[model samples]
Target: MGNLKGVALSLLFTSFVLHLPFAESDWFINYHIHVTNDLPLLKSPPNQPNLFLHCKSKNKDLGERGMVKGQDYTWDTKVNFLRTTLFFCKARWVGHKTRSFDAFVTDRDEMPCRHYHNSCMWSVRDDGIYFSKNNATWGNVYPW
Candidate 1:
């Protein structure tokens, strides 16, 4: 019983440490996803967190990692500000208002969707930001 208790305590400690948000790493956006097909040269907005993934459809998938529409995105790991673009558009037709917005992903276990079985895992490296998909598993970050 004592051995089991010790093992449990160690596991709990390890889990807690892993879940703790680490210091943001050095990362930046090299490019951005265009909000529309005709938006000439969509650059990353200035002075705001960059978006990682974006979509327009009510039911969308931002890679298998996460999804974003309007202003909601998932940041399940460390993210570099001024980098990454998650441009979302609500309309494909010309002259239509697009519910678009972008923001950097900096949190974990974020579910962009409330009814879907997807989760986000953000990571940072020399290149830029990267995210992965987990059905429910979290606390995992990856580099793009």
Candidate 2:
């Protein structure tokens, strides 16, 4: 009985140590948008098409809003969901024209977004869209 008790205690201690919170900052994903061109809101004039940013994960909208030129917006993951989750962001304007980018919670080489970092920035330019991870410079983000 004493041997069994010691084994149980050892197992408990091992489990505690393994499950302890990581010393480094927790993994997080952030979505940022920097609007550079004319992006009129829905409430804007009649002739101009309304422009907006939309982000979603597994059919759930994280944050979506009409964007303005020179304005920026960010949305950070609130909780850590161990499994891989794909988050998508889109730049859309009225008349059905849209450009999108996808980022995975898990590190994926094929994905445009990087993992285990701070934040990602999306730059909406007149010519094309781009993204930057952490403090890295912006790189072109192709439509999905």
Candidate 3:
């Protein structure tokens, strides 16, 4: 009986420690996902009406938002210790078109963002969706 009690207590403590927010490793915290609407480059008014986005993870839904040219929708989340944390987004170009893709992929984003500190950054341009790894350069990730 005493051995069982000790094992239970140890398991509880281990779970608590592993689930702590913002552990010593940056992998456990400060994960920011930035989604921007940079449509209509040469016009004062956007040609594609407005940009609508809905982003969420398995345990959380960030709802939906409408954005205009130069507008942004950003959020932050703490990555799970098991490395199962994933976040994806669905973007719509108003009356034109829409696309959906994974925004924060654990395995794919972990190494690149290891030193990023700010984590995954996504840009929604008139051409397509672009992604940056805590760097200035952006790559075309998805097209609408």
Give the candidates in order of lDDT, highest first. 3, 2, 1
- Please state the error at residue 10 of candidate 3 in Å: 5.6
Question: Candidate 2 lDDT, tens digit per residue, 105-143?
Answer: 434321343342445556665545766654457666553
In model 2, the runs with Cα more than 4 Å from the true position are 1-50, 78-83, 108-117, 134-136
Taking all chains together, each candidate's TM-score versus the true structure is 0.20, 0.55, 0.75
Error (Å) of candidate 2 at residue 28 is 7.4
lDDT of 1 by residue, 79-126 (tens): 344223243322221222323332223232223422234333333222
Better of 1 and 2 by lDDT: 2
Model 1's number of clashes is 7
The candidates, ranked best first by TM-score, are 3, 2, 1
Task: Evaluate model 1: give its lDDT.
Answer: 0.33
Clashing pairs in 2: none
Reference-based lDDT, each prediction: 0.33, 0.56, 0.80
Q: Report the number of the highest-lDDT candidate.
A: 3
Clashes of each: 7, 0, 0
Q: Name the candidate that leads on TM-score.
A: 3
Indicate the residue-level lDDT of 29 in model 2.
36
